[model samples]
Target: MACAWEESTKIRDVLIRPGTENDCNTIMDLIRELASFQGYPYAPQITAEILRRDGFGDNQQASFQTLLAVDRTTDKIIGYAVFFPFYSTWRGKGMFLEDLYVKPAHRKLGIGKLLLAHVSKRTLDSGGCQLRLSVLKTNPAKMFYSSLGFDNLTVDDGWETGRLDTNALEHLLESSGLTRS
Candidate 1:
């Protein structure tokens, strides 16, 4: 399915286009860069093969979609955004942006904003009513998102994010006597 922005969009020599299996390696590299920028304690467990399988493999198994921003002059990927459709009982259809990153050299050039605009456009085109994302409190991008009208739900609605790592999930399943068929 073509996104709303079917044609590759160029902003100051950067071309934004849909990501394909061929771009998985470059996308993995950008994912690592984003992990480093976020000061992740451990390296990301995702690999190009994983991205290719889960994102570009069988239609029923594909979990997400990606948009890549390439540097026109160098023909290299400089940024990417990963997103997927979701449903919210209260808000109806929505799009969740999993990651948005631009190479350090490309910051402050409106690339991030352009990427977001494309995501927003995609969300609206897909019958989604809202776009949502989570950002670390310490990340400077929080300010950028705020400037772009993203609300800090933690403050606005007192919502606390929760998570369960693999180990915790395993423990829950075992202790609860839940069996996966």
Candidate 2:
């Protein structure tokens, strides 16, 4: 299914539209750029093929959705937002924004906000009550998000984010004798 933002949603010359399989490569590039900008200790493991398979493949329903911000004059992808739906026991339905990124050259142009607004609108349209995301402690975008009404759960609710990498997950599964079917 094609996702489209209303014509009135355009910001300056940037247009937000649904991403397709053909956009996977560009999307992967942007993801890498974001990782680099954030000074990640390790490079991203995701590849264009993986993105295409999981997000635009013919075999199964898309696990996530993406929206691309394109510069109308150049028709180049300057940014993108990836999101997926999740159920929150306390809030009912919610949308988790996995990533929101814009090229350094494109910053402060309102593209990022426009993309986020589009995602928020989509979440609401789908019967979702909240939009959530996690940002690095040092990312300056935290202020931007705050200005847009995103609450920092860590500060407000004393929540701490946790994760287990592939190796740890494998070790846990082995210790628990959990075999993948």
Local lDDT at 89 for model 2: 97
Q: What is the C-alpha lDDT profile of model 2 across 128-179, one tens digit per residue?
A: 9999999998999999999999888999899998999999999999999997
Q: Residue 5 in model 1: shift from native, Å?
A: 23
Q: What residue pairs are clashing in model 2? A: none
For model 1, residues 7-49, the per-residue Cα lDDT tens digits are: 2334668888999999999899899989899999357898999
lDDT of 1 at 56: 95
Model 1 weakest 10-residue run by lDDT:
1-10
Q: For each candidate, C-alpha RMSD in Å?
A: 5.8, 5.6
Weakest lDDT window of 10 consecutive positions for candidate 2: 1-10
Q: TM-score for model 1? A: 0.89
Q: Tell me the lDDT of candidate 1.
A: 0.89
